[model samples]
Target chain A: MIRFEEVNFAYGARSVLRSVSLSVGFHERVAVLGGSGEGKTTILKLILGLIRPDTGSIIIDGDDITRRSESELRETRMKFSIVFQEGALFDSLDVKENVAFCLREYTDMSEDEINARVRHILASVGVEQALELMPEELSGGMHRRVSIARSLALDTPRMFLYDEPTTGLDPVNADNICGLIAELSKNGKGFIMVTHKVSDALKVADRFIFLRNGSLLFDGNRHELLNSDHPDIMIFINEVCIQGPSGA
Target chain B: MDVKRTISDLQDFYSLSLHGLLGIAGRPFYFKDALLQMDYAGAGSVVIVVIVDLFVGMALSLQLAAELSSLGLKMYIGMIVGISVVRELGPVVTALVFTGRVGAGMASELGSMALGHQVDTIRVFGLDPVKKLVTPRIVSSLIMLPALTVIGVAVSLLGGYYIAVFVSHQSGTVYWTSIRNILTVENVLAGASKPFIFAYLISSICCYMGLSTRGGSVGLRQATTRAVVMSIVMIIVADFVLTRMLLYVLGFSV
Candidate 1:
């Protein structure tokens, strides 16, 4: 399980996360929902050991990753994969190379083995046809899928961290991403997504967390989230679901 | 107003610079990246160097020929071209060219990465940005600049020779003999020394400017421009300082 205890992060004098505590059990598909700049990405970065909490601890799978050495952190990182908002694939490398990057860096696997594994992951993400394509050539949705394929190449019991997976996609492509998240969750990967999309969250998130003012305002199952008497939750749902007269 | 804070900032800057240096030690030595950087620095600057060197060499030969002809010593044209090209023009021109091409390119690319959060991505991956990005560039520039300066010296002399022999119609044999006589160990050593120092200055300044960039696209542009200008200025200043020091040590009049 991934756990945060009394986490507090501040940028200069301004506090971002204050005494925030949260946890995700093994095989849990948790959606952290919050509006923009509410420390959603900060939580993910802390989990990834990208940044340290000012005064707290982050423990993952029995290991306190917060203070691990760089090599140790890299070893731990192999257990998880992140799909950044913009995909973050190296522009000079093609889809195949991008997927095989970690493998090439950390493993002594032969070219044939790397190629086979890359092909398998690409096929799994439904981006096998884009193996030869550059990042600039891929659509936004396709780029995200390619990033997923790259993440899956390690094939560990991965924790897939997505930051606004559906931000720039059309509704159809957004639905496709939701479906992909659902499929990954069904496959038993620990999928933690940060999003404001109620429909997407409801479709794939088994557990929901609403963060407000740097603290967890709500943490419950999807059914509980949909059936809650909370006014804030209701407002969030309305904002995501309710369209204008002509459909926004 | 805040002396302690100022001291702390200075301390942090030194620590960061040391961190950057140590970080550079961990990257895989990429020969391909080195070759690409060299090509960008050296091959791309050939045309400009050739054009400028041709005019400079021709003008120097013309002035020297006119002065020496009055004393019936016109054959010393080759000596003049040889000493100037080997000891000063070659290294300085190569550095100026590198400042324009590779220094600006490094600053802009690294600055973009700083702005785009790619450097953060690298850090998260347990990779030091300095190691992965800056080290290979620094090492490559250090190695390649001297090699490029040699090429520059050759080209400049050839341009000078062509102007002296064909354009000016000075005796080819006399010109060649004068060059052979005047070419000394100090001249070659001095010429070779300049580029290594210039490479370090240019690469470090560019990398420093790049990593220090804040804001976004506008900030990156400013860093690139600053890197080029700083590198050029530093190279010129260093040239004067190094020349004086070298001449003093060699018992030569400055």
Candidate 2:
């Protein structure tokens, strides 16, 4: 459903992504794992057409978006929804308004219909009581769930991108987010989660792609990731993943 | 070069202003958003304009009366107060006050949103942030600045009236008569025109400063300050240009 062909991107003299390439198919939830500043989030940005690659093409839903203008790329982006690293809820709006944002903008659904779906999605995320609360009033976990609900409010989201959704949270909240990802996975929808959480990734990811220093280090299923002979990959999967920082 | 930077800034502001206005006329507009913003920026700022203009009028009358009394022209103080407030002080002061209040608010609110990635979320959802954020502000500023200016001019004239009649011992009827005679269609047109442009200048600059914010908290702070400072500078320069143009266009002496 999404493909990055030899993508290269940089900020001034500092390179962020280098000749990296990967593809995600339908029914596959790929987790891109790396430590901080390893271009994990950049992949989401490239796919969203928020930033263009220095070289290579980002194809989403069979359309190349590397050079698409901002206005033109918006149509291509309608097929995808993203949850930013910080949940990115609009502070001026309540949870109800935040979740109903895209629906009100893009859908012709009546206010009551929109409210019904918003209530249902908020319930699914376990935050229906938070519907009237402002973004600042919600807990970290509730904010993350509301952000997800906002993304899900869109009509057809072929791909969902989550950037460190569980980055700043207790284990309980992290598990709640993992459960949400797991639930989304069961629907056979494609997802690309950029996180440093190894245990979280293992909990919800069907395939893992590890990015290191702007390059792809490993790409395989869970069985292959655990059984691989690569020393650092093994150390990471066994030791670091178990004991390393969950949100670095 | 400072000259080069000024030219570039003006060019960029012009382009953004065009885009902001286009969004007001384009499809998918949030009319409710624009109305709410007008209430937020316009109606919200009117009281301040009136309060400030009233005191300014009193002070202006006092100073002008002192100067005129020395020359035995104390009776003409109303002409100076009325013309100055209408032709210059009213619009400019209202804009500066609004810049500090409403303009700074636009910058900080939008700046915080940019830092929080809400702007990016709007983009990812295939919505234009310019339309969602900038247009409403521009629309409100466009509306409030002029209305506030008219109210401000009236309040200042009333303030001037108190000072001229009681403080300076001038006849109230004579003072109002001079003001009524000098306040022509041309004078009203000239006084009323600048606020519209200043409103656009302040809102657009602040919005641009906000949308281009970088870093995090520190950047938001800088964007807010820059929005006010840059807008003041922009408003002053625009006032000078517009004043000169309107003076000539309305057939008044520059």
Please give, for residues A95-209, the per-residue lDDT of candidate 2 as tens digits.
9999998888878999899889999999988999998999888889999999999988875878789999899999899988988988976776878898887778887888999
Candidate 1, superposed: residue stretches over 4 Å from native: A11-15, A61-72, A228-231, A243-248, B1-27, B59-76, B166-169, B248-253
Stretches of candidate 2 above 4 Å error?
A: A229-235, A239-248, B1-13
Q: What is the TM-score of chain A alone in each candidate?
A: 0.92, 0.93
Residue-wise lDDT of candidate 1 within A103-196, one digit each (tens)? Answer: 8766789999999999998898788999999989999999989987877766663678888889899988888888887788777777889887
Model 2 lDDT tens row, B1-254:
58987898778768777899889888987888989889988788878988999999999998998889999998898889989999899988989999999999999998888888889899988988888899989988898889999999999999999999889899999889989987999888889889989998899989988887889889999999999999999888988898889888888763
Pick the TM-score winner.
Answer: 2
Question: For residue B214, what is the lDDT in candidate 2?
Answer: 85
DockQ of 1: 0.36
lDDT of all the models against the reference?
Answer: 0.79, 0.88
